[model samples]
Target: MSYHAIVIGSSAGGLHALKTIITGLDASFNIPVMIVQHMSPQSDNFMSRYLNQLSHLQIKEADEKEPIRQKHVYIAPPNFHLLIEEDKTLSLTVDEKVNYARPSIDVLFESAAYAYGKNLIGIVLTGANSDGSAGLKKIQEAGGLAIIQQPQTAEVSIMPQSAFDACPQAIVLSLEEIASFLNRLNNDTQSVAQPTST
Candidate 1:
């Protein structure tokens, strides 16, 4: 669908799945990815190191006011909410938790909605709570695409189930399927932009 950005949300059993997807993506993938993975404050820098090791793409624990860039994967810092700004940069805060998740998926999805609108692609993966449902819906409301991992295949089904119950149009598929879909989408976008030889 030619998305300019991808926003992903996950919790339980997400580390392996996320790594699998990111590692499968091409190194030059032009889409910027932002993620909100529910984590304890004690786990600070944990996901960063894990994902960095799993994928060649630049992966890091997001910092306050960090600028977003293509081909980079930005993970919300533990216990902080990550937001997208109008100018295409990232913002972080520790105001409060939504659905008991300080790095709430709703905050990232909603802010991404405002920042990228119709150009955004949202994905909800494994989790034990309903934190990402509202945010995924927000993305769709803003004319962005929404994807959810198949509940049956999810390590923890509550998150995807919530998304399913909330939005019937979401594309629910396995993690590998999602990656293949994104890879095609990225290539399709690039193809349309490249001028044919004269």
Candidate 2:
């Protein structure tokens, strides 16, 4: 099946995990990725800039009411909750935090599930808390793909472990495997989008 977008969530060790995955996606990858990485409210845009330099896809801090474009990665800015609207645009809010974080993974995943449904891929990476567990479950319920980093491979296992527990059908893979899988998905999508010679 073809996917339209990817929503990723992470907390502890997120920089390394995000870097690895972002680097794995080559220039041909067309899926738009939205990420909610737990960060201090006082954080700046350094993470997005750093990842942008390492990735072929455009990675930037998500802006309010911005349209979601393919081949781009939008990261929720500090102190705002990033949400996917049904119109395929992004919405940012300073609403109260969930799971003790402002840019809650659950918030992003749940909204993306509503917007993209079965065409969405929800991923939970290394984290210290179970913030994404409920959201990942919601994605699964909406018939979207749910992928979790294998707990053993995570620097901290609580988040992935919790997600696995919440989603028994989720595919568990190491970081390397996850990257390979995403690349394979990109290949499949590209093949499908190409015009077949008569």
Candidate 3:
């Protein structure tokens, strides 16, 4: 099945995990990816900038009202919660923190599940806390795909383990395996999008 978007949530040992997965994406990968990486409220755009330098996709801090576009990676800004609107546009809020994070993984994943439903893919990467488990479960309930980093391979296993506990059906993969799975999905989607020659 063709997926429209991907929502990723992470904390703690997230940077390395994000880099591994994003770098594995093919240059032709054409899907919007939204990420909520737990950070200090004073954090800057350095993470996005750093990832952009190493990725084929354009990675940036998401802007208010920005339309979600393919081949671009949008990261939630510090001290703000990023949400996906039903119209497929982005909105940002300084709402009270959930899971003690302004850019809570639950906020993004729930809104994305509502907006994209079965067309969404939600991923929970390595983290120290159980922040994303509920959100990933919501994604699964909405018929979206749910994936979690294998607890054994996670630098901090609490988050992935919590997610797996919440949604036992979610696929659990190592960092490398997760990357390969995304690449395969990208390839499949790309093949479907290409025009068939007579």
Candidate 4:
């Protein structure tokens, strides 16, 4: 039940959903979380601040070369690509857009798979576009887990629908169900860290 990292992707109608899911996670969660929510450089800085206010966790726009932490949530700053480094550090790239987004979900997911291997968990949230679909598929291909919001329950169904089509086996659940699932993962991961015998 333990993983090295978690990567999430989202677009339109994502703000509230993102807040809900991240806020549901407790401060004791020790699995590195990285997010690539489609945004513009001129976008409001409220995402980090808002989630921070709502959750017990620390939320921030990630800095280049910063160490990725399990108990913290890292949001890709508007207009940058977030990648997970093998050394467990955050990497930001200014490369051309993928799927028409500077902070493409595909970029983050692919890089996360490369960095975390079987220890990656990718979640795709509400959005109007199909940005996170490719990334979610990659996570599945890399022996990791993929979760998508139930399209019917999403504010914007296209994103979740796209991910569902890409990875049919992905866990499709409601926002509350998604919250429950993540919490279980968080607790299971923490339990493993305790001193135990083989």
TM-score (all chains, Cα) for each model: 0.96, 0.98, 0.97, 0.95
lDDT of 4 by residue, 24-137 (tens): 776676777898888877886789998888888788999999998768899998988998888889989999989999889999999899888778899999998899888888
Sort by TM-score, top down from the best: 2, 3, 1, 4
Residue ranges of candidate 3 with Cα displaced over 4 Å: none
Candidate lDDT scores, in order, read 0.90, 0.94, 0.94, 0.87
lDDT comparing candidate 1 with the true structure: 0.90
> Candidate 2's residue-wise lDDT over 80-111, tens digit each?
99999999999999999999998999999999
Clashes in model 4: which pairs? none
Give lDDT tens digits, candidate 1, residues 1-198: 568899999999989779878988886677889998888877868888888987878999888778888788999988889999989989989888898998999999999999999999999999999998999999999999999999999999999999989888999999999988888888887777675787
Candidate 2 matches the true fold with a TM-score of 0.98
**Cα misplacement distance, residue 73 of candidate 4 (Å):** 0.2
Q: Global lDDT for candidate 4?
A: 0.87
Worst 10 residues of 4 by lDDT: 189-198
Report the error of model 4 at residue 1, Å: 3.6
Global Cα RMSD, each model? 1.1, 0.9, 0.9, 1.6
**lDDT per residue (tens digit) for residues 118-193 in model 3:** 9889999999888889999999999999999999999899999999999999999998998789888877877777
